[model samples]
Target: MKIAFVGKGGSGKTTLSSLFIRHLAATGAPVVAVDADINQHLGVALGLDEAAASMPAMGEHLALIKDYLRGTNPRIASAGKMIKTTPPGDGSRLLRLCEDNPVYDACARLVELDGGAVRLMVTGPFTDADLGVACYHSKTGAVELFLNHLVDGRDEYVVVDMTAGSDSFASGMFTRFDITFLVAEPTRKGISVYRQYKEYTRDFGVTLKVVGNKVQGRDDLDFLREQVGDDLLVTIGHSDWVRAMEKGRPPRFDLLEEPNRRALCTLHTAVAAAYEVRDWERYTRQMTHFHLKNAHSWGNERTGVDLAAQVDPGFVLGEGLAASA
Candidate 1:
């Protein structure tokens, strides 16, 4: 299953995303953690030194990735015409979690965490050169394309720490995940994004659940419930362990407080239950919707081809490789 953590800038979404990845990894499950946020500190949070955590950025290798995923798909025309929202067709390559593929070999790194080995992939950070010349979406498009081509199965997980705030809605990337955990603090600024995200994704049939972060007492929990109501899936209290980890003095996952640990378990249970309900039909429709949206908006003009034709009429997502083979 694919899961995403999103919230306001200071709402601890990155920290929570790291904890969830470690929790899933400790269970000896196949998991991949992606730092899709512009800030890009998920590596340090997972206990890697700055140097080791800095794997090759996916953004820098867009052409290579496009070429590999495009495979022999006839509808795509060429790698140059493959936009970020392009869906895989009959002959396109599909990826499995931790699979030995060219894209994974080039961009993913294996790191040992508390429970087990977890693969880490990063969207790369906004460099100084990108300051005035580029938009962050161009860099994050790598993640969207990766998710588009990936076909994860049962017991396999992909956890993404999305960009802060509703900026995630800037592209079709927001619609890529199975579930999006909206991490909101007990602040107006925090829940404000939740409202914005809810409104943005309301018509899209997204399974959005709120995870209350930094809860101190009954009042904080009450505040979250008052604002979000039943949309709150779980609440993680303030943790000295997380604070210490942020300070560069990391500790064992077992040292985390009980309530926070339970919260993580609840999240895992929710995500696991979601795996049973993978809606491939709806998923394909969404992929097509965004592909057409992009094609009409800019892709056609840029590529001089009707990108909508790239969608394979009979191509099913999870069985793409088998069908193509």
Candidate 2:
């Protein structure tokens, strides 16, 4: 299953995501964590050392990626010209995650975090050279492309920590996830983001679940319940352990508070339940619509190409596939 955690900047999205990843790993599940945020702090939360977490961003190596994927196919000349969601054609490239293909190998190296059951890959930090450039777009685009091309096992989990705020709406990043956990605190600003995200994602078929974070007592939980109501999935109580870990204290996932651990387990169960829905036809239709909309807006206006025509053949309009496309 593919899951993304998104919310207001200080809403503890990263914290929850990291804990969730660790929880999955602890249970012997295979998972890959992608830090799609510009701040790039998921590594710290994942217990990776500073240097290991600071690996090169995939956006920095687009040229190599294009060459590897395009191969002998003359249709795509650059990564910027690649429509990740577009299905591969006669001469186009396709990728299976963890496969031995050159493109897969290169992309794996770019994002893979070593030495754990749960691997991590980061979009890297924003640098001085990114001044005046749409750097965040570049990172988001890279992740989108990678996800679009990846083929994973049914049991495998791909969890992404997305950038904060509504800026992600500018791209189709919101549509890329099977479930998007909107971590919201009990504050007004946090609930405001939830409203905006809920309204925006309603038409996209994106499952927006509210994960209440930093709950101190009954009042905080009450606030979230009042604001989020049925949209609320679970609540994570305030953790002094998490606070201390963030402040350079020794790390210990095994020592997590019971409430926090239970919350993570509840989230895992929710994600597993989502996979059973299996409304592939509806999902394909939504994806096709999104592709067509983007094609008209970006492809036709900018490149004179009918991007919708490139929709993957495997995703038939009225048919349900046994596996994910």
Candidate 3:
């Protein structure tokens, strides 16, 4: 299963993503946690020290990736010629998770998080070179490219902490996950984000569920329920332990309050349930929609390639989690 956590900034999506990764790891599940957010704090949240958290960002290695993938292939001459989400054809590169490949090690260094049952990867922090530029687009495009070619088995999982706000919609990143947990507080701004996300993704065929966070009492819960209604999947009550952990204490999943633990379990169950509800036709349609939407940018305008025709012919809804590469 590939899950993404997205919400307005400070809505606690990163915190929930870290905790959920910990929960899966503790259960002996095969999991990969990705800190795709530009802020890059999922490392610390996953119990890594500052030094450990400071791994290479995949964005910084785009040139190497292009060289490795294009490798003597006459079709693709440069990184700009490659489509991030298109599957590799004959003589093109294919990337498999945990496999030995030319770019795998560098990619692993950038994406893999250390310690625990869950492997971690970060997109890396923004640099001074990025000032006054939309360089994060390249960073996120690296992540999208990585995931585009990655192959995972039925028992494996990928959890990504996406960037805050509707910025993710700027790229096809919104279409990459099987389930997107949108964390929202019981406030107007929070609910506004939910509305924006819904409007943006309504036609994308992505499964969206609201995870209410920072609820203080019944009123907060009531507000969330009223705003999100059937879309609200679960509520995580405020926790002092989480606050303390953020303030420099070591993160101990075992010390999570009972309510929070229950919420995590509920989230896990919801994700599992999502796999059972398959709609391949809709999935394919949405995939085509985004492919066509970006056709001019990633295809004709640059490489003169028919990008829509490059959509994975074998792609099936829910199959990403049910089959091996």
Candidate 4:
């Protein structure tokens, strides 16, 4: 399934995303981990090296896409291949600086990597970097290459480890996949924030689910149900395994930890079951919403998608704050 991990900052989205990557990979399916949060570091949580990503952003990528698209923007034509940043042996920071003048560059870079579509997608933050990446994506053949990777080549699963709080990937015009999950602490604000995303993504024709991360007490769980309707929401309790993982520590999920192993097992099962999701219709039956202003034009790489029809420039710009948050 096409899956994404989201929540307000420090709600364990990255750690959960990393664990999910291992969980899906354990099942032997190829997984693609896409890091969609510009500020949060999935590479650190996953223990990947930064040197893996070396492409220049904005300066080169944006221009490339604009030129290919026949745009007369001044930044589009003046360029030779710029210096590619070398991975820093730590994937947390790309050798290339983060400047998402045009956010399409992120998508473009991933597409250019041979075998970019793996069973797991280990990617970087979805930022201005993605703008230049967009330039690369303008070419139909390139996009087709990436889309084919997601489709026919079929990377077993796609895991987007998003930055906490608001982010560009999350704020984009339309939801991009089969399942969109909201993860939050059980605090009053957390509950409301979880619902906010659940309700917002639904506005764009995307399925949304709630996963209560670091949950505490029966009362909070009960309140969560009351707030989100309790149908299929999941509760992930506090655990040291998760704590250890957050500090770049290893063997985080020790079976001996009182409730951790059990928690991990239960959470893992929930993730495994997420593949069966088909909830877009059930959740949005009552809301009077339209796709975010530009929700119509965001990535529609999936087959048989007529993206032009979904173009909503205002919606797209409106979402920039949401995406960058």
What TM-score against the true fold does each predicted structure earn? 0.97, 0.85, 0.85, 0.56
Question: Where in model 1 is the C-alpha error above 4 Å?
Answer: 319-325
TM-score of 3: 0.85
lDDT of 1 by residue, 89-181 (tens): 777887888568788788989989777988899999999999999878888888899898888877889999999986798788888888999
What TM-score would candidate 4 get against the native?
Answer: 0.56
Q: Can you rank all candidates by lDDT, best first?
A: 1, 3, 2, 4
- Model 2 agreement with the true structure over 111-230: per-residue lDDT tens digits: 222224665667777778788975576666667766654545556788999999887686776877778899999999999999999999888778889999888889998999999999
Q: Give a tens-digit lDDT track for model 3, residues 78-113.
A: 566665554433344645555567555775543332
How far does residue 124 in candidate 2 sit from its true spot (Å)? Answer: 2.6
Error of 2 at 323 (Å): 12
Per-residue lDDT over 1-325 for candidate 4, one digit per residue giving the tens place of the 0 to 100 score: 5566778877777777766566555555556555555553665555544554433333324334323332222221221210111001111111111133232444433321111223222233345655755531122222211211122113356666555554423233124455566777777777666766765655455666677777678987877777888533577776665566556565522232555445445655555565465342322221112222222334233323433332222221110122121
Instruction: Provide the RMSD of all predictions against the true structure, rounded to 1 decimal.
Output: 1.4, 3.7, 3.5, 12.4
lDDT accuracy of residue 205 in candidate 3: 74
Top TM-score model: 1
Best by lDDT: 1
Pitting candidate 2 against candidate 4, the one with the higher lDDT is 2
